[model samples]
Target chain A: MKKCSQCQNNLNYNCETCILRLSGKTLFYNVPSSLLQEIEHVDEHISINTKIYEENESNTYLYSITKGIVKLSITDASYKTRATSLLTAGMSFGLEVINKSSYLQNATSITPVKVCKIKLAREQINESKSLLENTLKKWQENITNQNQIIEKFSMGDTHTRIIRLFHYLKENSPLEEKNNFYLPRLEDISSIVNVSKENCSRALSKIKKMKEIILVDKKSKIYKT
Target chain B: MKKCSQCQNNLNYNCETCILRLSGKTLFYNVPSSLLQEIEHVDEHISINTKIYEENESNTYLYSITKGIVKLSITDASYKTRATSLLTAGMSFGLEVINKSSYLQNATSITPVKVCKIKLAREQINESKSLLENTLKKWQENITNQNQIIEKFSMGDTHTRIIRLFHYLKENSPLEEKNNFYLPRLEDISSIVNVSKENCSRALSKIKKMKEIILVDKKSKIYKT
Candidate 1:
């Protein structure tokens, strides 16, 4: 079994705090603790669906989630929102601050989110090797995720895309189950998959009939083999 | 009149070598000359359609083209390729070396490509502040490009996507042309627009009928107003 996020115990239980401590995959992962301590930070609590930052507008602060999910998205000229990626605990948002450019995507709270907002400074990034490395690492990870999404869309029908979408959510979410887990609401899933709500529902039903997903609740389910 | 790539004079000639020196928007921009000179580098010549590197596999050397075009693409499970971005002169490739992970996109030479391949060494990166800064800058530029792509697809129809593709190419190229430019094969345009070849052809014909484009040669054209 894979190691647990919190205690590394390899047991199934809701360990929400595990995501916070196991942020080895985040920007703070390899940074010097002293530097982290010296930085200015604010603890922010946001309601579900709250807008954290708008694309190409905000650049004052960088953020790291301690609880809940933040979905990074982009809106076209027509104001069509495309879900770029999901930011769970340990993932840092507002990373474009390093380049001192405009935000590339919008950040929105997917659930009730708790985040630590840090004042962004170029000096901090210049002096910290670990910080720069982690930022590049995250950028690389985002690129990989984008390619994977493109891959899914390029080859799959609606049903296949929906299955991959669920697999994607489970992969990004905080772990608590072996085969069973909860997901964002259908609308969120539809936004990520870039399909209509009806199409998304149809795909979900198809997956259910195929015995690929066992419904545990309206938003929770099992990835049945 | 637009400034020439080499002499800054208004001219109407192809400057094949001009892009090599005019790289203000690339990673090498703002970097010290001595640091660049100290690095071990090799000049490589790639034929058209040569595979520079495959996505999710190659991580051998970092590359920057001096001439021609390199298209970054992603191939799905069914081996269908979608062009993600164009890496022109000054723009670099093989950046996944920073993350020490798999490549996020395939780098394919769309023309006869002149490239400088460098073996990325961590010691060199850690010691030079310039290298790290340039890399970060490139990452930020890439994020911006990705957002632009998302914006284009999300907002516009296929015709607009084709127009934006041309605009994007003009923006990234070395020289500024007011109403004329050469393009890659229709297949390349089709790949970039994520549309079928017949659809791309239909869009091209529509634009031609709309007097937005004037056919010159098979690959060269005039963007008529």
Candidate 2:
């Protein structure tokens, strides 16, 4: 873990400067500078290798991915794991605690990662009314988009579903072009789409042949075109 | 539609009196009376047979269910319809448009309904920024809850999914011990679970036999003991 030289603070997540750089064009565009200062006190740094949150454990802090990717996944009574979504730099996670007592899923860092943690209590949240409202608004928008993705999977055919997913990723990507995207592991994608690994491979191959996307490797990489 | 005798305004959605009655012991108990007044407004009343919004339509208003039930649903490109969730008295809907250009689903009155519609770009929302912020916070919480339900359907078995749904209703319902609840048609429930009508019926019957719940009719009803 690295520490901030100026404030002598352990720096695991992005510094305020880094957040300004990554999210400046998107969600951070309209946030007032004074409001950013309010967040400064709440930020704490963390570093994790590979797996992070354990299943069925209490989660007390929310994290913003600063330098790497994290996978949020859930397991059933039979111990079958299903990946729900992926969080990368500039995205937030661990908000399920607002509705439930404990984390329902396990979140693991897909790579060696740095995350900024914000400790929140209900009373503290109630005090920072405006900031809390703004955060909740962003959270709601993210969940709505996720629900739409689930709806597509439930209703659309495989080809249509893949197309929809591609479009969604392209529209939402921080990158300039869909073809230049950073893809997650094939297993993670398969878990999200609820398809067998073999099926996911075939689907990817089919799409690749059509020039819809390009796969860099059979496992952990892809580039959409 | 009946009008409020006190103000001669259309009495639909939750009136101030109704809200006071419902807020007795819920999470909303501490919401200030002045804040409630600030958020309250007259809304149009719609009959149960009327459709509040159509698939792919541009939704321009946000609504709070006051007197009856509403169903939020969507149709695919092939015109297959699915109910995403049901909203009852005291719950709000149509918030997906907050940051989007248009709505992703259709909302309809499941029973003769009264809904207080908020004009997001005009009215009290603009004048009272704090009130608006609070409203958005509550709306965001609702969306988060909806996402959890979607996640459950995507990952859990039919039985577990049903249990989760029942638990959610029980926890959120305004009335305790009166677990008898009203919902849309059985086909609507099938759409939400992404299962065939026969499969949904079988699942419900299985749960009923297990003493988990009882259906009062083939459509438009459900109850948990």
Candidate 3:
């Protein structure tokens, strides 16, 4: 049994016995155990900043995050990079399998990450009721989450956006205890919230001074007070 | 058999012969003609500023726009309303049918609108491969489109955001000629682009002064010169 070096968890690529599935925090949670056991997947431990997939690349597999966070972004027509989403454990990306189209965003791991990659053919998905249901459900949830995040950041000043972003991270983190969670790099946070790194740093300091969040371990561990 | 009062076009609720189907610009385009013939749908003519659906309401049916535009927005935690999407003809909304969940945003008619509403059950979608395929494809496109809009708007200042918003609207409008399109009210445009109405108007004036866009007919018809 190989162990995941990043999270130090014993790694099993099988879906049926996976810890994320056991904890009921995976995209396949609704899938029946029998079907889960029949599914074949590969688990990969990705180092920080590794490119999981590139925009416009051929998307052949759907990826489910097992540990750590991944930033999904795209370089727009103006050559500006904007973060579209931050997917953590239990969420999935590379949903272009449904359309068999190219990836629309570049996905890169923001932390040492573990992902379960499943090659889900469109026909295979259409054949399995549970899998199709779960896929569409995740797709809907992803859109809703993105919309909410955009709404949150669009409504406030830089500091307010930073505060809302932290609150959002705290709410979405998969940790059993939500008091503490891994914070992505300042650059990643600034990109996600559409603010400059300096502005984000200033906002973070203000938030800390206001006692909203406590950053420890050189800002890696963020605690919501 | 009836006429759509909003667009002044002949209306047919049947999926097989609908104009949007022939134009290949609808969510159900890929469904088989046999299945399309069997599907029952309703055509509705909605007045301007009408609330099509409220956020968190039970989502039972999916709506395909046949004419005009609709705005999708949500009130954030701070009670500020943020527009998430602006859907024009041939686009669809109320996608929560996939999960049988509540609507995630409040959808309102930005102009006199016509929609073909379909009650799509999850089992019905799973039973038909093409319908499921089309639904998933639309879902993927919707997310991609939303992300691109967010990315484009996040790149620059208020004027830049408004310009990007118009370019987006021009690209998305289903008119046969893209040289001109209906510009939503300043309030709607401001909300959609995350700027104040005053700021939006000021930016529009600057754009007009630079001849980037020509606003005509009481600022309703916007022409790209």
Which candidate gets the maximum lDDT versus the true structure? 3
A2 in model 1: Cα distance from truth in Å? 29
2 or 3, which is superior by TM-score? 3
Please state the error at residue B183 of candidate 1 in Å: 3.5
Highest-scoring model, DockQ: 3
Tens-digit lDDT track for model 2 on B14-70? 434466335642222344566556553456667654688876678676776666667
Question: All candidates' lDDT scores?
Answer: 0.67, 0.57, 0.75
**Model 2 chain A: worst 10 consecutive residues (lDDT sum):** A40-49
At residue A97, candidate 2 shows an lDDT of: 50
- List model 3's recovered fraction of native interface contacts, to 2 decimals: 0.65
lDDT, candidate 3, B1-225, per-residue tens: 777645567776666567787777887776777665566666888876788889989858789988877888888777766777777788888888658889888898876678987777777776576677778877886787677556666456888898887777677654556656657778777778777789889988898899888865454464663
Query: Between 1 and 3, whose DockQ is larger?
Result: 3
lDDT of 3 by residue, A1-225 (tens): 866644567886667667777776677875776665556566778876688889989868778998777888888767666787878888899988658899988898876678988776677666567778788888987887677566666456898787777766666554556666556678778778888788889988887898787764464464654
- Runs in model 3 deviating more than 4 A are A2-9, A12-14, A19-24, A167-178, A205-215, A218-225, B3-14, B170-178, B206-216, B219-225
Interface RMSD of each: 2.2, 5.2, 1.9
Model 3 global lDDT (CA atoms, 0 to 1): 0.75
